[model samples]
Target: MEAVDLTAEQRAIIEADASDLAVSAGAGSGKTRVLVERYVQLLRECSIPQIAAITFTEAAAAEMRDRVRREVMSDPALEQHRALLDEAAIGTVHSLGLRLLREHPVEAGLDPAAAVLADDEAELLRRAACIEAIDAAAEVGGERTRALLGLGVYHAGLQLPRMVAQRDAVGAAFAAMGAYSADWPSYVRATLEAHYEPRQTAIRGQAEEIAWQIRRDAGNVTERLAEVAGAVLQPLTAAREAREWGDFAALLAEARSQTNLQSGGNAPAAVNVKGAMKELRELDDDAGKLPAWNEHDEPALEVLAGLRALFEDSVRRYEAAKQAQNALDYLDLELGAVDLLRDHPAVAAAVRGRFLHLMVDESQDINPVQAELIELIAGGNGDGARPALFLVGDARQSIYRFRGADVHRFPAQQALV
Candidate 1:
């Protein structure tokens, strides 16, 4: 209603109706204000149900709905649309998904009355699935499964639940890693390259810096202190030249093993050496203990294979278990919606036609599945007519990696926009 107080950038975001946009602004920069302003503009051009504002949390969605209502009611020109505000698609992505799945349960192949499981209930179901999967694997007694059992049933039981929880990520990693039955050393080397190289680089620099300090500090002390300093420096230097990460880990292990380096006659010198050794100990703690996969480590690889197989079994059983109880987890909601959209083009087109503007907030925390769902609804200028997707997020504020949030997607979407 008024452009005098709004900045040029805010006006641009509010007025950009045709092109997709990815906006990045820090906290307290009025991101929510921009979203509301944009939604107001979209509301003027389309019906209420044709606009969707997807937020990160339920509280955020509620706040957004309230703010939009306030903006609409505050403007005399927008009074005619006041009654339809509650009918707008304003909620979290999961909420939108759940709504869509409920609308088209037959297309999604889901039970119409399935309940969404709470966190505690999902954990119980996941654990039960893992236990059943392990029991089945033990019964089959394949070679790899037997090797996994060799690691001890207790250990398998402990580790499988974690694997089940991170099933999607672990499955992608395993697929990238190729067959565990391949050459063990080569497999280990590849794994190190993919995951451990960054840590190795950081640890190498830290160890060398500490070694330099120890050498300088020990020189003014006794010859015994100097000898102990040499002992620390040897591995530090060797670790620097190490061709493999396992060798570097071995060097740190050697440094860690030397706990009783003492000289009785020179108490002050011994104390000085001990202090420097204390820093080395701290360094060892920071140095990630890389797995030492030797050439003959076929059993360990077999165990990994077994674990992967068990995770597969567990996921199948877990879905079945949820189905039996007529319950679906959050993952099921997002993925089920994606499947409905992908497999049913008519349904996807119907939903797409209804929502001409798709706005997503806190988009940095979206995982691949969520991204796929978003793309399926409003991908691009494919048919020359679709919803214009507006993604707003600050990658610097992305902290949900453990929950499978990929901050990289924010910038990737920026490039597309």
Candidate 2:
């Protein structure tokens, strides 16, 4: 067997400066063949035999590895360099990221047994948040931030941060409604529709009804709940902080002294002290209003138990929502991973040092995060030394937009060299 021959252009491509080169060859123009020859050349010519070739797919990496082995073993001239070929690393960018992430999990501040976190994890967090929101709203009243977070969590696919930024845009749109108007509503409404797409109409109606009811029942949800809870808790909390232990006694007595203290029950308490009292009461007149847990033949206990269960459920949801916020989202993958590489010199050095050649098969499709990682691996060489930059991709083939890959990244900086 003989070594595969490279055409004149392929020869130029292979022998070109692998240190920093971007071949914007069109599709089906033998770009891969050029890569194979270049890789073999690096093994044969370049003393630096550590080849870390980043491919677009696992299959591509496999094929390249196979080609290199065939080219190395078949040719007597190159057979001596077969050992160098074995040291080559060729794989997808994702595999590379995972490798780096795994090697430096602690440095990344990631759990040793951290899961990639399925989309369901986000949904679980969102559902948990929603449940808490309903309960918190019932007991202590709703929070806009919490509501937004709940909506955002539930709609993880929508990219809440982006949607939130668009909220300002929607506000601007709302302001300029007479002009740039379309099939969109106020940002809030759009969020409502987008967030509640499954129950779009129903959720919208439900949220609207809840909003109106909250307003109607409490007459200004924010002020009512805060004012009510603040007024009561403020006095108690302030009194306690001020060492007014007697105030807490009075606060306790206020509840203990009141009879049919259902005075606050005209509609509902912005806070749930009335219901709390109702549940705490020894009354049996309204068996229907008894708590779920208390409903076991013991009329008074039923009311209290049901109320306790509901409140407990709400509080539990709130806690879950809080925890979900820390879970990894897609953005976490990019941002967190990049942060890990940059912050951990040891891990970064390990990867950057292990890979002598940083070959990105599709430079154009690289995101800021991916590009940043490449730069990190390349030791900020940006087309310099250490892991010699070997990028090959056509600007035209860079079709990915969501991962931050855009036409601007190509030939944008002096890295073009």
Candidate 3:
């Protein structure tokens, strides 16, 4: 093949050894060109049948295939190998996975003629599964379940169908990208620890000062001021001894509920108690500013857990329904391919042998499942001779997160490579 114009970095990438490699470049920086050139170089050493190049989109795959074919045709000596290009694995990851599953149906545990459900068809199946899951949940009634049912009803009335319709995308994010798995309690506690812990000390100090002032002025203080001081002491002591998070939250709530302690009221002692009560109220307000995890957050967490469970249950039901119909979705293609490679060593070896060089485009846009697919296909399982794995992507361009693309995987995958 003729030497094409390439930057120093591009030349380095093309000349890299058979070890795994990751290439990062900005948009319009010839990433795809570098990939094609590298593929052509590999073709010189390996047969076209031994090469596999995966891209993010069908258009990119087609473009890459065309570019490679053009580069091959441009070389007079390489004309004989042009026909083998059509048989090479060059397509989107999903297409490659579907091909893998088709090639090893029994090993993948999928029917040989299983049909892939289109988006609209998958939506129907998902809706059916969600309805079934909701019915099942409703059959078993409890306080939590009732709360879940109410949420389901609210969702149904508001936007449940729309949300369910978009479940494939959202589910993909959760399953592949690890979204919504945050440690909320830890986060809330951390925030409170940072913002409220110091304030707790200040509030306790203020309570002690107020108590001292009341005792010092006891001779001049009215009955009303003494009673108000006792009211303040109750929660002050409770706050001092507050150990559990729930107790602290309750103390804050009780402090906030002292609405009767007005700034100035009809009673004569109200004037004397106003300043202390105002300070206490200010402290209560500060406590309220902290996360309300102990009182109001549990229900939210429970509901969120329930919704996640429902979504998972729906997914399982949806998968069962698809399997029963001998059909699959886009996700199933990658998962089935991965499972096949994982569970059957012989089959994995055969697949690995077929593609001696694996090249992936838009590597930053790949989710964990797709990354695993690439790793398995490239023999990253510490098994036999690992194939040369080449990846090209710009992490800054990883904008397909809604489609399960996780930019964080870029560094991790780079380290793995």
Candidate 4:
């Protein structure tokens, strides 16, 4: 109704009828006004009452809806469209996902009553399992197995529940800054590249050298066996021979009395070192699956497994609850929306068709997933055809890595511009 100061270039981009579109609205660049104008256009100019306005954050969505509502209340013409504005779908990606999940839980193979898993609970279960493996492996040899057992022992000794404060501090610090909360796997990969990979190679090389020395130490077992072949019933040499010649700790231990009778006074004190090593290895293999503190073999594997199962059951409950929640973190909203659009292409396309006049604020905060979701809805803008998108965001204000927001998406959008 009333013209606001806008460059002809801005007006052209906003009014363009394209299949796909992206607008790079810098901060304080009338981005919200652009969004409101587009909504008004759709309702008044395009006569589309049914529209969905999605934003990265619930706060942003609420802000936009409020401004639009304020406009509707003030303008007599828009006042008639106020009811339609009220009916318009406006939400964060996660809110939308939860809404859909509530409507279609069957599709996700999740019960409507499920819960979200708490990290502490998951950590507890993992620790219990790890400790069990370590205790079991204590009877074995080798630095690697020892290290595995040590992890279990460490877990057992910890007071995990008491460290809730520390855990929250860590989470807060991470969320306040850093990409670890944004894309965990990518962050881990970066960490490995910077620290672990080179160290791992060095450790492996050292292990090989140690293995060769162990083998050479093993050669003397046969000569010692010959010297004490008769005097000792089950010589240390024989025990060493059994362990070295073949993987036979259990085989050597069976009927120690019989072996002593056959050779006369020797049965090298029946130590199941090899069997312990095997058990240690089993724990080592499972340590990661278990907890960090309970990284041991002293605890029984069965006990650990049972505790782990309990923890997992709790975890399952927690996860289900979290998913069922109507609320979500910023990233969850984007991902959920992307999934919804991807799964229900027809519904998305129908929505997009109605919004040939879409405007987005905070374009810089849009991550890859959100970008894809917009693309799916808008079609391909640079190719040129309807409901072109006008996005306004200041790259400097684009500091939401905790929600996986990337500045890179802005550059890609720039090419389209």
Which candidate has the highest TM-score of all?
A: 1
Question: Which candidate, 1 or 2, has the higher TM-score?
Answer: 1
Give, for candidate 4, the lowest lDDT window spanning 10 residues: 255-264
List model 3 lDDT by residue over 1-417, tens digit each. 345667777888888877789888889998888898899888778788888899988789989989988988888767778888788799988888899888887777778778988768987887788778777777776433654665856573234334454465556534542334355546545665666667666655665675455445434555665566666666656766776545765775575455364433545445446665666667676665655445666556556555666667776787789889888887778877888888898988888777788888988999878888887877456757667888888889997786668998777777767
For candidate 2, give the lDDT of residue 368.
Answer: 58
lDDT of 3: 0.72
**Model 4 RMSD in angstroms:** 19.3
Ordered list by TM-score, greatest first:
1, 3, 2, 4
lDDT of 2 by residue, 24-137 (tens): 778888788878778777766554346677776567889988987897788787776776665566776665665566667777777655545444564555455445544454
Total backbone collisions for each predicted model: 0, 8, 0, 51
45-161 per-residue lDDT for model 1 (tens digits): 787888888897878999989988988899987887899987879998888899899999789887887899876798889999988987777788895367456767788777767
lDDT against the true structure, per candidate, is: 0.78, 0.53, 0.72, 0.48
TM-score of 2: 0.48
Off by over 4 Å in 3: 1-4, 131-294
Candidate 2 residue spans exceeding 4 A from truth: 1-5, 45-49, 76-87, 115-337, 346-350, 379-385, 413-416
For model 4, the superposed segments whose C-alpha errors exceed 4 Å read 1-21, 47-49, 98-337, 353-357, 380-387, 413-417
- Model 4 lDDT, residue 55, Cα: 71
Query: Best by lDDT, which number?
Result: 1
